[model samples]
Target: MTVNGRRVPVLSAEGVTVRIGGRVLLDAVDLDVHAGEVLALVGPNGAGKSTLLGVIAGDTQPDRGRTVLDGTDLRRWRLGDLARRRALLTQANSVAFPFTVREVVAMGRAPWASLPEGDDDEAIIEESLAATDTTHLHSRTFPTLSGGEKARASLSRALAQRAGVLLLDEPTAAVDLRHQEIVLELARTVADGGGAVVVVLHDLELAAAWSDRLVMISDGRIRAAGPPHQVLTAELVEEVYRQPVLVHRHPVTGDLLVTPDRRGSRPTRTPVAPAAGAALDSAFVKEFS
Candidate 1:
């Protein structure tokens, strides 16, 4: 959207801050989600990536600053209204009741109930299930599905929503290798369809390959935000992740690959205290000599 000839972001977080028990989870972080692109939030554990995502999704209240959707404050929008525009797939896919997979996926259409848009709900649900490879489990109870199945089913729900903005937190965390690639491809498809997709990814290689932009968060603040090639470097990875790594391009795909550098020398001996009887064993060996 453009206002006064200026392009506006579909969703944005400005100076967003969140604190819990005097510990800062997010500190004055700003981010923008634009349509037709996939933006990834990546960092080590407890680096405020999820907290910032929740703030943008309106699931977590910010102690300072604000999050906006189409220039309107997120807090000002009604829950149902927000649900129609933005769908969030959280890390946990737990359902309290024994809802069938189909039933759980259908819940995404609740915001459009009694509206004309509900007419396509069934078709969308089926497409979503098939897209996520969850169609076969539609009749099964969500509680009975395996971890990867549950994750896909939950993703199917978010896809069924048809929201323009998707906030996904580790959508492929529990998925297998094949499904992980599938999930990333789906994210790209969503972005290609003109949706704004913001995903939290732990795998830097996947993020670099999938996302149009990468945001590296550390210590409750954004360390860098830019194109993957610019943001993901060997020095930055080592500094932020605190582990030496080798960042290189894939041989065929040409996309970036990040792997820990395991070239260090191993110690000659174990570093531990000897047992009480170890010296006596040494003396017995000496007697044999």
Candidate 2:
């Protein structure tokens, strides 16, 4: 894919805008997801992060512009072919029916049924389950699983698809700390395997640690885009998130760490004098007497 001799991104939003009921969800956002890199989309709640992801996933159509996948407009690709190229894992992983874990993961292979590797679906399914640490839940019905368990199982299903482009919306939202790392590691692994990964993350530290680049959005527009060190500055954090934050390097991993600047957000309380507390003390005694 090329634009005037420049190589194009694996997936991109070209001047995309989305508006619903007199409110704008996305405002002409231009973004890219490239192969061999994990891109993190982050923002405050209602900042249009998920909506932008939905646009990239083809689940939401923008009011203006278009989503391009591998240089071709997403609307032009056949649904099955598009499924084979890119797999989307939405935030909600609800299964309407009582499908077993293994059965649910196998659904990813539907697009590949006409291909030569269709017969190898079982092996692929098992591999995906093992990768996401959901193999133990293979026999359990998806609806009977816990939220975190269901999250892991759903991830296994997306992994089973073996798509070149992965669009994951908060893949670790329901998992524990350990599994959160596991999911991010799997995303890094996918990129390492020569695929493109675009993830929506609320955890700024995790996004900074795993992503090759970060795209920070606020009020339906991009606030910053670049490496963590460049994009996640104290000014940008405070301005876009509307909260004071301290952006610093971790001592152990040297990764960028974002923490709330509590001192800046509020004033600390000091002890009052005994004389100043006399009225409160008298009231307390009178109430108890």
Best by TM-score: 1
Kindly list the per-residue Cα lDDT of model 1 for residues 177-277, writing each as its tens digit: 99999998999999999999999999999999999999999999999999999999999999999999999997898989999998774557555457746
Q: What are the TM-scores, per candidate, against the unseen true structure? A: 0.91, 0.90
Q: lDDT values of the candidates?
A: 0.94, 0.92
lDDT of 2 by residue, 1-289 (tens): 4579986688989999999999999899999888899999998999999999899989899999999998789999999998899999998999999999999999999999979978899999999999989999999999999999999999999998989999899998999999999999999999999999999999999999999999999999998999878889999889988888999998988988999998855678798899879988998999999
User: Ten-residue segment with the worst summed lDDT in candidate 1?
Assistant: 264-273
Clashing pairs in 1: none
lDDT of 2 at 32: 86
